[model samples]
Target chain A: MNDSRYVSTAQVAEVLGVGVTTVKRWVDEGILPAHRTAGGHRKLLLADVLRLARQSNFPNQNLGPLFAAGHALVPAHVQDLEQALFVALERGDGDLVRSLIQGAYRRGVPVDDLADGVIAPAMQRIGHDWETGKIDVFHEHRGSQLCVAALHELIGLVSSSAAGRRPLALGGAPEKDPYVLTSLLAELVLRQDGWQVVNLGPNTPLASLRKAVNELKPRLLWLTVSYLEDADTFLTEYRQLYQESDRLGVPVAVGGRALTDSLRARMPYTTYGDGMAHLSAFARTLSPGKRRPPRGRPTKQSNG
Target chain B: MNDSRYVSTAQVAEVLGVGVTTVKRWVDEGILPAHRTAGGHRKLLLADVLRLARQSNFPNQNLGPLFAAGHALVPAHVQDLEQALFVALERGDGDLVRSLIQGAYRRGVPVDDLADGVIAPAMQRIGHDWETGKIDVFHEHRGSQLCVAALHELIGLVSSSAAGRRPLALGGAPEKDPYVLTSLLAELVLRQDGWQVVNLGPNTPLASLRKAVNELKPRLLWLTVSYLEDADTFLTEYRQLYQESDRLGVPVAVGGRALTDSLRARMPYTTYGDGMAHLSAFARTLSPGKRRPPRGRPTKQSNG
Candidate 1:
């Protein structure tokens, strides 16, 4: 192992402006990946440290020592983010992928663009590679896991922005859709614009969604169809959900690769989005200004 | 709706050591629950604000202004935490529930205690209420949703502490379990002790676990069976998984409400945990000191 290629725990702590204990704790928790020396000292690759610093959005001047130490930080460009993300996912370097997305967002890349341009394409390429036998099934599963982790972190970061009295947006992947990324992205995108979201997550049956709509009474309902187990069952149940949403006067935003031209033609969604940009745009139309009050149904039992 | 009982966003910002914009953002994102005045100003109840402060672990001295406003801040006792959590969940107060859990954890409550003492009993009460017709199904669902959200937030907070070269612990809820909280809690408890966890989430089939074992080769495995749809299938599949894990020398820790005493006799596990405490104790036994390298299988394709 090349010791010079890695930085010590204290060096990373100083760079990130945190105590050494915090850095050590972060490493122990698997937040910051590190290697143990023969003498049991923790060391981190300079590249990983740089990624962490960038993701934390620390000032450039604070990272002067890192550069002075002879390690180069290859700044990822917006155009190359997708490629970078793809490589990170392929390597199963979850922290790197997280930092790339979060660092870009903190640097002012819009959520919709990140979703539509970066993650969507990178994940699509991963899928394509799997289909062509370029990657193993485990590689593909690992990619999804990395993506989900990154998205959850982003959601936590962005969630503080969508405050009081916002219109609620409830959504999930359809039954057998199985993909968690698209639905999670939808939550993040809507949340970026300050919509309260109840993400039912993947494999949500349409009947449960209808029940959710009746119970939660969200202003908007979004569905991401990644893979359908049975097309006929989906079409029938989805149509029922559409009619239910229509009766409740709620707008539905539908998207995902599984919603091909043929499928779109048969479904009755208020908006069909090709990407997060479209979802962002469509959701904006039903923003807080048009917030609808819950129906005049009898209120459920109160805790009081 | 009483203005006198409410505090402005600025007041919350001051107490929490953040900017007014950040407070507004938290309210917008539903991180902080707030009420909108007829004049369009955001005002939060004093109790809710206190919950937020406590959850954030802000010092009491900084909360002098809030105290002077003539609103009492009820200091939740350790014994009362479960009751408070139950009330918050019953009211569908996700933010409060999150604040309660996060605040307790920050104040030195162990992860295992929080899982076993606070969350489990509260959720169990909610389940009992639903069964006895004391609460509607939505109330039960809402409780689960709130619990999941709180657990995810706590996971994100604790993740920074578990930094380097930790043993990977992989597991999830079995197919038809459909409960996310137990599996997530398992992840948090393990992560607290510096374990790298890959929680496959609810509804994970046994075959998927077998595949994951072959690929990830985790040092340990855990399954939280909150609900079982079919006994015979789970038994057969679970037996196969137990044999596989045993063959690979991975310890399996099993728990949850659905794992009845009868089911235990039928399944084979290295350890059977009744609560998070048992899981936590069992996991510590297999800590990094007993670290095992990946098996002698040929290394798969590397991103490098």
Candidate 2:
């Protein structure tokens, strides 16, 4: 029980092979085990810091910098990206928001994958923080604006890619859903899955959606409603739309957090309960020409 | 588009073969599709009601009695049970609480599976509701107590089941986690998977967990942490525990939302991301004597 032992933040940084700023960030995020000296400088426990260094893939150095960078080299970084995006949005810093999305995309992060991995989680956290009064409504709105802009930019990048299978997939928030994050994510996912997506954006009118379907002739129509209270209104309109669309032989997929109970039962279209799972299933469906291997085939694949 | 009709609650209920009370409850819970007339009575579209009736797995006549009893034969009735348990907990109605647990158990739902299927989902809904201010703090606490009591009762019943295999399993809240619902679900899942679980309950000190491990000699320990802030504390303690326990030849299995970060790092030890998947995996691990037939070899038993 050598509790008397201590190490400098620099030593911790050395152990993790990261810079002092990174170590400080780790301390700020509470990733590093630390104590403060009488003069208020951070002190690290030698044994604990060493253990963390070993556990973290910090390139065989002190763990301080890696901790500060908020678990860089892992999906955990996405969490930080999410926070940064939200903060940038709150401040209405369009430049910062654009930079973040561009940086992630340049790093080979798929726009759709980024939506699922980074944007969606960030939006969820922002909403939670706002609801908990950890953040104000202004900040939430700011974050949303930034999100919309980022989506717009990302959608442009998507348009540059070679279109794969479907001509178009339409999705957006039903009239009552204020939060369009799920819809945005769905649009990004479908676009990446090689469908030309006509994103109607949030709170699109039902009549407009029907008109869009008639005019755009999307191969699939996707609808997202995040409020259960809106389900009846949605279904009432949906039944009419489904009747008309069914004649055109287009399949409709509906999903959102608000889907439960009679709403789930009453909707004749396909429903997805979870966002990412639904997107993955949709992607699988769109990946044409890939067949399931016959039974008993030995296969070797690298670990992810 | 015949805008000429609106269905009364009775007519809608008649179509579903359910009592108006049940339809109202479903509406209140945002489970059913309905609207209010000028006088405020509920109205349902005929097509929507029929779709719900079909989805509920009830004959038109049966719906009336089921609705009268405030029940529906939906496959996810187990989810409804969870909601009811949480609602009873929220209301602090001890009688309703006790009856739901008893009914579920006596109805041949495995006590543990009932916990997983009913209790966990209910708790999630409760948490979400509480966060959204749809339910108050007192209700949340009441719901938590009911779930804890239900788990206790189920554990007792499971202990008496001679037909069940009991693998040694440990359960406890990860550091800083106030919510015991996850740990409770883990205990139920383990028990349902035929593992005898030692539920250490909420917020056990790390040292106490170590001592219990030494005394109980459990083959596997389940740790759950939900809050992001607690991750650092849990990880530090868990690393030490893992090191010490590994020497004693015991493996610790961890899950819950907290394990999300740990998954990316490829940490040592097994981690379950999904409760059902985790339970099935644990069951498979325990039942090593069972094996699937070679691929493409048709056996007398159908794997399906």
Candidate 3:
């Protein structure tokens, strides 16, 4: 017991009742905080040991200060913008979104960069919290409104160009799911990749969409659906649309949480999984060239 | 057809053969890049639409370049360092671990922060690629080694005073389901929460862990098992361990992908679904005296 000066990873495992390799992995992942002595031996603090004992039974306590202290121990600028954005959304503060975006832009963060780094992550956290029941429906709705309004304003800030960029069709499933944020993030990512987007705001009728396709002759349609409940109905409608659209040479791309399900087999189109990372990939597939490096690529970088 | 100068969101949706609601959601999510005309009508670029159409069938193909583009879009100062670290890991450059740590530290970024923000994400990407056969086992091993070494060195830089801060024990299940990354991430999170961590690494023998618990009497034992294949065995062993550990007055905390499965019943122990967020909550649980704002309380600052 007196050997508390320096605890071997094995001893630490014994204390925690875990395997030695797990301890090493924790060390490797920077999970278990440790330090080496002048002689290069690892040591663990006593207090942390006690905290671990309590953590198993009780999580969701306030350890912010402890984390803050630990963060202070490590050197780096902690990005708290996402949390702030979440709060702002809950409050439905379009003004706050504007200010945040302006601030990020002033800091040399691009519009798309703001969308990806700040807006998207913030939205995801909000969605996750809302889904987990940590935040109520009203709070989630308020946040969504603020974000959508801010995004609209951001669209206004970016100038309309006549660069002959290809047009994209964007929309999502019914309001019951209410996850338009995924589509918004996708739009931002596509715009960043130099694609021109035509965002049809949520809840458009299928007949109207078919008519638009017949009239406008858009080359691609991008759809976002987050709920699995409407999968069977949506697929039935999608099959009809797909069969019709194929004749017109217009392709449809589907994405969001719903697409992750195995039911995708019933749908004829492509499914993009969670995150803008996948959305951007879907957008890229629409472009006719082989995979090209972003910087050296020939496309003009639009502020949109 | 001649109205190509401006396309209504409705028209765009029709062109894509999807419901207007779907299109609007895309617009709202920023998935479909769009510009509003002076009258506030959304316009889509023909080229962008065409590109989306071409890529609709192959979503996975977009991953590589999108990831590359994302890395490129990060702030320049961090970009080179991040890329170098990833490349080193990709190449299995063992010395690069120390060099990257030193470089980041010199630039005022803590090694832990770098690992969390950059290294971990990169590793996830590499792991995904490895799983999908996009990257070979060699690359995966190389990246894992570099990360392991880098994290170990980073832990070495902390002061012994920090080592005395708190004690935590970290471990996971056997090697056939080797997912030490989760444990590693958990350890970092706990450490950041001011707990001193003893990482047991991976594929640890259960008996040895029990023996360690007897010897060290550490406060907490963290177990991570990421795969589904070992869930039944793990659960059986976990029940036994729970009974045994209960006798010792130590709690077992469980986490990783497997914990979320519906088939698995909620055990008596705590389960963390999200990684860092869960760890943060776990830390708070350990320290009851800390002040936590109500879930709905508005905070002024943002956390990214």
Candidate 4:
């Protein structure tokens, strides 16, 4: 493994005959096994990028080596769109807000980029303003509602494009969590990858998750922890949830800001991701059909 | 005795300073009484149409008698767009499908009209084609997904425009009912009337509804009856649901095609609607603050 064997995302896109954004999405999703430079620019390993270019002809691109060495198509960013959206949110222009979002999605902006890059920072600003008395609670609430609605619309819009029975995915915020957005983000990201995903919504009890597990029988269950008052207390509450999930034989994946190092160590059975992108990447590796045993049948491990 | 009380929907629309589609929607929703002639042309009762015009000025439109007397606007029937959507769905053009729906909606075509006139009929055609072997199950399922996704996107789009503290409204299809779409339609309609709505999704158990009512403390609960295998059995199942809703002090409203006159007569606590438009009109009349007492306390009626 050569430490210096790294290529810029643009070079990867050129080698793949796709947009830089697409290449970045693959790298960001951990699909191409890329690393970041000291200045925080994405740098894909040359061998990994070349291997990916070879493996995923994508059936549509039909590119040869010459095309693989194609020139970079276009640059990607929403420097101005983000500002326009902030103003639109403040003014509460629902139509423009949606159009802007839809346009971005159409332009190939990945859901994770929309969530972490744009909305997250914008939402942080809005929250900070509300905290410092720069804006009223009503204004903040209205802003929040606009963002949530946009996400819901975007999710619904992309979800329609799924042509067949995609992977089954279910997720929601854990009990006492006010953070529903992350779950929606996860749903959108998963759905974009052609997963038939459902969000259980915020403040979901563990029993409710267990019930959903039994009913929907989803292949993957995502528990989002947006906040934790006490790491000890949170771990204590979710430990039983993990045991129940294991008993039910469902894969449990966890993520969010509150998962401290100690808490994560204690719940080592769970898979973790930093955000929607990571979760989506992990989901790509799961197969619902192969993972679960026939209903009420003995596990293959047990049979063995 | 006035047989000439009936007028074309266009005439009614012209007199109301609204589009022809609005009149047709009003008639279709049972908001204003109307009947179809032998040629299947919608003819509204002049008296009923006038009464509705008097009642619904709708904040933005400043139409007195003069606006009603204005020239006839564009033609109504979503027929052409529906045909286009059929092709789009057949070809799996997601963007075109969404564009068609959004364009219709932007042209002042109400949600109820879209659901009843376009999607319902198009879906029927798709189902028929599937049954006749004109298309495969994959085609039918794909078409259904497109329609459902459009609805979800539409709901999110409209729900964002609501301002202020909206009355909390909750709804879903009961267990074993494959009627998720109706619940979503109800959500869109209610949200338009400044109601904070939550759709619990299809195949919801009564126990789940009960649990949601207790937790969310919604002012009005909508239980959509999309299908009933046995009227008597269905009535029995939801009668207990009505009692649970009553116990929780939340009013239950039921709708959908499966409802029969005989079955409906037994459930006196429920309000019924033809589709989304009527349900929206009904939701407008609810007052959450005045209707229920503070949570965990006895009802004012009981305390008194």
Top model by DockQ, which number? 1
Q: Please, what are the lDDT tens digits per residue for candidate 1 over residues A1-304?
A: 3344677787676556555887888889887889998899998888888776555433332353343233322234545777888998887766567667766665446789989989988898998997897876556666776687678767776775334688898888887666778988898898777788887777777887887788788899998989988888899999999999999998999988888898789889999989989998998888845533368853221111
Q: Give the per-residue lDDT digits (tens) of candidate 3, residues B161-249.
A: 22112465544443345554666566655554446555555555455456546655667776666665665666666677766677887
**Which 10-residue window in model 2 chain A sums to the lowest lDDT?**
A57-66
Cα error, residue A202 of model 1, in Å, equals 3.3
Which of the two candidates, 1 or 2, achieves a greater DockQ against the reference? Answer: 1
Write candidate 3's Cα lDDT for A1-304 as tens digits: 2232334565456334445776676666666677776796666553554355354321211121122112222112225655666666665544455456544443335555566567777777877886897755434444654565445444433434436655554444433444556655656556556665544434434544555456556667666776546666766776776776778877777766567557776678654455566666666677763345467533422243
Model 4 regions more than 4 Å off: A1-81, A160-164, A229-233, A247-249, A287-304, B1-152, B156-304
Per TM-score, the best of the predicted structures is 1
Docking class of 2: incorrect
Q: Tell me the docking grade of candidate 1.
A: incorrect
- What value does the lDDT take at residue A124 in candidate 4? 64
Worst 10 residues of 3 chain A by lDDT: A58-67
List where candidate 1 sits over 4 angstroms from the true fold.
A1-15, A18-79, A124-142, A161-164, A205-208, A214-217, A230-237, A288-304, B1-79, B124-145, B160-164, B205-208, B214-217, B228-240, B288-304
Model 3 gets an lDDT of 0.52
Model 4: docking quality category: incorrect
Best by lDDT: 1
> Per-residue CA lDDT of candidate 4, range A109-172, in tens?
6667777666766666676776897755434444565676677677754542222245677777
Instruction: Mark the regions of model 2 whose C-alpha exceeds 4 Å error after superposition.
Output: A1-77, A83-95, A110-112, A161-166, A287-304, B1-304
Model 3: how far is B108 from its true place, Å?
A: 54
